[model samples]
Target chain A: MEAFITYTLFAMLVATALAAVQLNRLFAVVMLSGVFSLLSAVLFVVLDAPDVAFTEAAVGAGISTVLMLGTLALTSRTEKSSSRSSAIPLLVVIVTGIVLVYGTLDMPNFGSANTPANTHIAAQFIEKTPHQIDVPNIVTAILASYRGYDTLGEVVVVFTAGIGVLLLIGRLGRRGERQKQIGRGE
Target chain B: MRHHLILRVVTKLLAAPIMLFALYVQFHGDFSPGGGFQAGVIFAVAFILFGIVFGLDKVQQVFPTWIVHRLMALGALIYGGTGVVTMLLGKAYLDYSALAHHPEHGQHYGIFAVELGVGVTVSAVMISVYYAFAGRPPRISDEEW
Candidate 1:
């Protein structure tokens, strides 16, 4: 039953992706992309990755969709039709997709126990977490205690990205005042 | 948007619950599927929904840009500070065992602090990014949307 649900969700994801690619209206494209993310979240759940599914649902569907809509507000709603030939780009895309699909062929089966991912350091984390952190959730234990520095680095990266965005487009201090003045003039 | 009676009413009713849920995800992360990143996005979603319905100006009034900016830095500081505290306690950086007599207690404390830091920064950054994008004089007007 779970496998059935997973296949159904994958089918929906493919349809949504195709629709998003074919649509010229940016609004519909954005909505379809949101649907794509939500479908991926369901797939994550079927795969028993609830933590990842939660993040995908919140960040991908919720935040990204809103951000994309905001971008659409600032840009054109409809995609501009390019007169240039699309043959080369299409070929490149096809080649890349083929290469990616080929690469996945060597991957271990989804939940196989003997896979490298399951055999490597994961064994120690599972074995020692009860004695070390004593946390009920192994995911939290690995992320926060075992790999604290990495998570701290991630937080710093997020902070830096925020600052970069603020520097580029944030209406702050004098810039905000100027924007307000421009709004009034309009 | 100002005249969208149902949207305004529903948004107002939903915002608090959304925030409450974010908090639950943030604090209950150790035992559940959620964590700071998800909670942060959820928190920002509440504010973004309000901004969409009631207008950006009102949302800004409630959560000013300065606060968001400060929070973005503050969260990173909190995460780094936890590491620094551990180092000061004569343990390696980010060593939670230094925080308490029992290793488990220290781990709990360290994780809670860092998760709070992560949640604060993620939500603030998400909000600030939204503000940067939406605060601009939109190319399309409200009627068009």
Candidate 2:
């Protein structure tokens, strides 16, 4: 039953991708991408990574969709048809896809217990988290306690990205006043 | 948008609960499947939804751009400050064991503080990005959609 569900989800994901590609309407494509995110979130849940599923649902399906709509509002609604031939781009994509599949051929089978990833420090984290952190959620323990530095780094990266965005497009501080001055032709 | 009665009413009804849920995800993360990043994004969604239904100016009044910009830095400061405090206490950076007499309790404290930092920064960043995108004048009119 689980396999059936997974297969169905993968099929739906492919269908959504195909539909999004085929649609020239930017709005429909955005909605379809949201659908794709939702499907991928469900797949994450089926794979027993609920934390990932939550992030995917919130960030991918929810926030990204809103951002895409906002972008669409600022830009054109329909994709402009390019006069250039797509044959080369299609070929490049196909070749990259094949190479990616070939690269994955050496990966350990899904859910294998003795995989290196499962055999490594993952076992230690699982064993020590209960006593060291006393947190019921091991993912949180690992993310915040064990790997605190990495999480801190991630937060800083987020901060830097926000500042970059604000500098580029956000009207803040003296920049807003300057923009107003330009608008007023002063 | 102003004439979209259903959207306005629905947003009004849903915004508070959505925010409450974000808080739940933020604090309850240690026991659940969610954490700071997801909570932050969810929290931002509420404000974004309001902005979408009402207007940028209305939402900005409630959460001004200045506050959002400050919050973007404040969260990272909190996270880094926690580490600095730990280091000052004679432990390595981000070593939560020094926060309390008991290492386990200290770990809890550290995780809570750090997660809060993550949550704050994420939500602020998401909101600020939304503001940046939505604040701009649209090239196309609503009628185009």
Candidate 3:
């Protein structure tokens, strides 16, 4: 049953990606991408990574779709046709896909007990988290406690991106100054 | 949007619950499947939904761009300041063990504080980005949608 569900999800994900790529309407493409994200979130859940599934659903499916819609409002709704041929890009993509699949062939089977990832510090985290952090969720303990520095860096990165966006297109100055600048642009 | 009574009413109904869910995800993360990043984005989704349904001006009145920008900085400060506090207490940077007499309690406090910082920054940044995108004049009209 799980295998069937996973297969169905992968099929749907591929279909969504293909549709998004083929669609010329930017709006539809954005919506399809949201669907893709939703499918990926489900896949993550099936893989037992609920934390990742949550992030994917919220960030990828929800916020990204809204932001892309906002972007479409500011720009064109339809994609412009490219004059260049797609054959070279297709060849490159196929090559990359083949290489990636070949690479994954050497990976341990899904959820194998003796996989390096399962054998490594994961056991230590699982063993120690209950006593050291007393957190019910080992993921949270690892993210917020064990790897706190990395989380801090991620937060600062988010902060920096926000500042960058604000400076670029945000309402940065006083209302009067902005109005004057708009007046000058006209 | 003014004429879209269903959307407006539905948005109004949904916004509060979404915000509440975000908070739940934020604080309950240690026991559940979510954490600050997910919670923050979920929180921003509420405000973004309001902005979309009711129009930008109304949402801005409620949230204000200035406060959003300030919050964008404040989250990072909270996270970094926790590290600084630990350092002052004679532990390495971000060592939460020094936070309380009991190391486990300190870990709890540290995780809570750090997650809050992550949540605050993420939500604020998401909202701020939405503002930047939506605040601009649209090249196309609503009829285009």
Candidate 4:
């Protein structure tokens, strides 16, 4: 059942990728990219990382698609630059994909109890967490408590990205407001 | 747009719940799948939705740019202060063991405070960034990137 599900998802991903690449309209490409992200999130859930899956769904399918559409609004939404797609970039992409797939061949067998992650300090956190916090979700316990620092750091990183965006757009906002006031005066 | 009557009404109704959910995610993070980062994104999304449905100018009116800037720094300050309090109480940096009279309870108290700080900073900054992006000034000369 699991193998069938995984194979189906992989097929969906391939179809989506082909759709994204072959689409003539930039809008269609962006929308197909969103579809691809949703499939990837589903795959993540099937792999037992529900938290990661949730985030991928939220950020990848939701926010990223919105951002792409917003950018699409300000620019041409049709593929006007297809003349630039030549042999070099395509070869580079193919090589990178091949290397990545080859690297996955040496991956550890699935769900091994004696795996390093399951037997190390991580195991202690995973094992003791439920008793300490009484939370059924062991991942949540590890993130919120035992490894809270990393989570805090991630929050700070997100906050920093927000600050960076604010800095970049601050002047633009003021100018926009001024123009709005000027328009109202007319 | 003002013409999108459904959007306007939905956004008005959703604005409160989104903010409230962010708070819930922030506070209940210790027991749930949500935390500061997720809360921040949702909070930002709510305001971003408001900005999109309404005008950026109106959204800015609701949360002025200046307030957002101060919130960015304030979040870090609150987070650091918790650590400072722990140190003052003779524990390691961010050692929530000192947050309450009893060490175990203190851990809970400390984590909550820090998470609140994280949530506040995250929500504010996220909204601020979206405001920056959505509310950008129209170009005098049309250009493409």
User: Which candidate leads in DockQ?
Assistant: 3
Worst 10 residues of 4 chain B by lDDT: B136-145
**Leading candidate by lDDT:** 3
In candidate 2, stretches whose alpha carbon ends up further than 4 angstroms from where it belongs are A173-186
True contacts kept of 2: 0.93
Which lDDT tens digits does candidate 2 get at residues B15-50? 999999999999999999998999999999999999
Residue lDDT tens for model 3, A105-174: 9999998999989999999999999999999999999999899989988998899998898888886866
B35-63 per-residue lDDT for model 1 (tens digits):
88889999999999999898889999999
| Backbone clash total, candidate 3 | 0
Interface RMSD of each: 0.7, 0.8, 0.7, 3.0
lDDT of 3 at A149: 83
Candidate 2 lDDT at A184 equals: 100
DockQ of each: 0.86, 0.88, 0.90, 0.30
True contacts kept of each: 0.88, 0.93, 0.95, 0.26
Q: Which tens-of-lDDT digit does each residue in B93-114 have in candidate 3? A: 9999999999999999999999
Candidate 2 chain A — worst ten consecutive residues by lDDT sum?
Answer: A167-176
